[model samples]
Target: MRAVIATEPGGPEVLTVAELPDPEAGPGEVVLDVAAAGLNRADLLQRMGFYPPPPGASDVMGMECSGTVAAVGPDVEGWSVGDRACALLAGGGYATKVAVPAGQLMPIPDGVDLVTAAALPEVACTVWSNVFMVAGLQPGEAFLVHGGAGGIGTMAIQLASELGAKVFTTGGTAEKLAACAALGADVTINYRDEDFVEVIREVTDGRGVDVILDNMGAKYLGRNVDTLATEGRLVIIGMQGGTRAELDINALLRKRGAIIATTLRSRPTAEKSAICASVVEHVWPLVAEGLVQPIVHGTMPLAEARAAHALMESGDHMGKILLTT
Candidate 1:
């Protein structure tokens, strides 16, 4: 097997691919001959040594991949060699092969090809678990997601719209905002020129939004709270902005709003499996029906993972970037 590793904690230049021994499946796990791996913000953080995998997970940077099952461990069931699947992983996805817990594997939605399936696991599981499962976003509610043209944002826009929420998103450029609107964003704010809080406030007739999926962390915290409707939920999944911030408890109390900060990478396996199962049940049907879809920007060879990381860091690409084996 071949894998990408950071020679040192620094820039994308530190990444290098090297030959390594193939991983063996453990109890209740399976090994995949990877078809493609998805680039994520977390992968860049891992490469820079800010986010390490949980204990015993491989040091590879990827958190999701699509592949064929190559081996299954004892106690694993309902999967076998040659099974085509996409997987959520704790690590080890930036390789030609990876070991995944059996429960985290998902069948490809009808009509999605093998490689594009790599784009679904992380975004689907993250959005479904955080927005619907935890935040309890319901039909007729208003929803907002930051970075509307990125991997998670695109998926969030489509899913929230398809599920009957009035979707709102923030993007930096005309092209990106247009894309988000086409993907069903009812309101698109140019974060550079317009304040999302004001835009959301005006569009919701000052009721504000029922839910907000924020990635900017501290940079948007105060405003996010201001934008939330009474009893609204704000879920923060990334700290792309600086982490530390002061909270306005009195303001939150007035609205009875809730704020939650979470990460998908560090979740317990059983919890992740449950999220995957729920996604299959609730999200896959919409995907198969063509009401929701994966947004892939482009593909690069697995060996060029360094370039892929650079592209993501540049923040110039729209949608998910994949590394194909």
Candidate 2:
């Protein structure tokens, strides 16, 4: 099988196509004939040597994939060869074939194409688990998402809106913010030109938002606490901004706030499977009903994984970037 490998940690230049042995399904796992794969910010981080795959994970890049089941291992049931499915993985997506736990597999929702299905698992699991499962964003409550035009942000906005939350988001430019608004964001703030904390406070009548989905770690820590309601929750999924910043403990205490940070990729297989199972049961119907759809910015060949990485870094894309095998 041909897959992209990071020869060394650096730029996109480090990515190259290499022929590797095809992975076989282990107990409770399935082997997929890869059709399409999704590119994520974490993919770039892993390529730059800052993020390594968890124990027993593939060295190849790719977090989620949509493909057909080529084979299934022992103890797996309810699926068979040739099932059209998408799956979340720890790694090895940029290839013609990869193996994943059967529990992590999700049947492709009716009416969604294989390529688009590739774009769903990562963002869906990330947003659903963080915003709803962890933060517990409630209907009629204010929800703020940073990087509004991103795959994670776009999904978050739609999911929160579908659940009847008042959604707000921050982007770097007017166009990005507009895109966010079109995706059901009630308030869109240009973080470059406006103070999001102040804007969020003003929009919430000075009470602050009920929940904030953040990727900017240390940089937004203080401001996030400042823009929280009396019992608000801040969920951190990434650290795009610098990871070191001073914290105001008093602010958190005064607001009776909570801060939670996690990465889905590094989780144990059992945990990831549990999350995927929940998504399959609950969120899959939303896609099937056409209430939410995968927002794909572009697709490239698997061999051009480097170019995919370059496009993601440019920050010009509005949604998910995909790589097809």
Candidate 3:
């Protein structure tokens, strides 16, 4: 198997492709012949030594991949060799072959191809679990997500809009904002110039949003609270803007709002399985009907992991970036 490994804690230059031993399926697991891997911000964090894989998991830098089952281990059911799937993973996606827990695999939706399927698992699971399952966004409500043109943002915008919520998003560039609008974002704000909180408030006529899917952690915490409608819910999944911001408990109490912070990578297998099941039951139908779709910005050979990482870090791409094996 050929896999991308980090030589040390550093920049994209530390990534290199090398031949490595093929992984085998363990109990309740399966080995996949990987078709493609999705590049995520977490991968870059792992490469820079800011994030590390959970205990008893692969150290490779990827959180999801699309592939075929090559081997199924004992205790696994409803799967066998030759099955095609896209999986949410804890690690080890940047390779020609990788092992995954059986419960993490999700069947590809009707209109999606193998390589593009690689882009769905993480974003779909992340957005579905956080925005709907946790935040409980309702139809006819208002919702906002930061970084609207990125992988998770794209999926969140489409799904929220399709489900009848008015969608709001923030982007740094015109092209990115326009791309987001094409995907169903109702209000697109340029975070570089306009204030998202103010824009959202004005758009809703002084009533803020009912739910917010925010990745910008502490930097937006206060404003996110200020942007919330009474009894609103805010779900935070990333800390790209830094962690540890002060909270205005009085304001939150006054509005009766709730805030939640979570991560998909560290969840137990059973929880991930539940999230996958809900996604298949709820999200997949929309995807199959073409109400929601994967937004792939580009693809590169697996060996070009370094370039992919650089491109993702540059933040110039509008959607998911895939590395094909």
Task: Please provide, for model 3 over 84-173, each residue's C-alpha lDDT reduced to its tens digit, 9 standing for 90 to 100.
Answer: 999999999999999999889999999999999999999999999999999999999999999999999999999999999999999999
Compute the lDDT of residue 282 as modeled in candidate 2: 75
Q: Ten consecutive residues with minimal summed lDDT in candidate 3?
A: 197-206
Candidate 1 deviates by what RMSD?
0.6
Error of 1 at 144 (Å): 0.5
Query: Can you list the residue pairs that collide in candidate 3?
Result: none
Task: Assess the local accuracy of residue 270 in candidate 1 as a C-alpha lDDT between 0 and 100.
Answer: 95
**With candidate 2 superimposed using the best TM-score fit, by how many Å does residue 43's alpha carbon deviate from the native?**
0.7
Name the weakest run of 10 consecutive residues (lDDT summed) in model 1: 196-205
**TM values, all candidates:** 0.99, 0.99, 0.99
lDDT of 1 by residue, 1-325 (tens): 9999999999999999999999999999999999999999999988899999999899888999999999999999899899999999999999999999998999999999999999999999999999999999999999999999999999999999999999999999999999999999998999999998888878778999999999999999999999999999999999998898999999999999999988888889999999999999999999999999999999999889889999999999999999999
Writing each residue's lDDT as its tens digit, candidate 2 over 145-230 gives: 99989999999999899989999899998888888888899999888789998888777789999999999998889899999999
- Number of colliding residue pairs in model 2: 0
- C-alpha lDDT (0 to 100) for residue 311 of candidate 2: 93
Write the number of the candidate with greater lDDT, choosing between 1 and 2: 1
